[model samples]
Target: MNNLNTLIADYFKDSIYLLIENAIDIHNNAINKPNDIYLSGKLMAYVEVLSLLQMQAQAFSIPLESLKLDKFEAEKDLLSSRIISKEEIIKT
Candidate 1:
């Protein structure tokens, strides 16, 4: 049981980093060319990845409130800033 918990925790930790890097790439690309046609689509993809990251954190029993940990805060901040509007999340 302990090993399983550790494995799951490690997976989530790695996933968080991957998601963060992906988000940064998208953000940078969008910023580099304001007229880029794919900016919205790439950002939308990042938002989806962030939602998965959030779900994984919850599955591991980690509270969203604790995302402020020094190791996780930078990624969390980037993810938070790209949140899809509530209306978009709720759209059918």
Candidate 2:
């Protein structure tokens, strides 16, 4: 049970990381190419990711208010600095 809890906690953490990374990537790309179709596409992708993350948090019983994007991104940045790559998430 302890192992399972640890795994789930890690999974939740990774999910938040991927969401922030993707959002940042999309935002950066959109800024670099503000005149192309890529801007809208990336923006939409980021929004969709936020929606999905919210749903996942709800499913995992995490409080919605506790999982706001700003808080999640800050937490992810700290967690990311300790981790090597996003590939670790695929293990679960």
- TM-score per candidate, in order? 0.55, 0.51
What is the model-wide C-alpha lDDT for candidate 2? Answer: 0.56
As a TM-score, model 2 comes out at 0.51
lDDT of 1 at 69: 24
Runs in model 2 with CA error above 4 Å? 55-61, 64-92
lDDT of candidate 1 over 10-63, digit per residue (tens): 786666556666666676566566677788577667766676667766798877
- Lowest-sum lDDT 10-residue window in model 1: 83-92
The best candidate by TM-score is: 1
Provide the overall lDDT of each model, using Cα atoms, as 2-decimal numbers. 0.57, 0.56
Most accurate candidate by lDDT = 1
Tell me the deviation in Å of residue 30 in model 1.
0.5
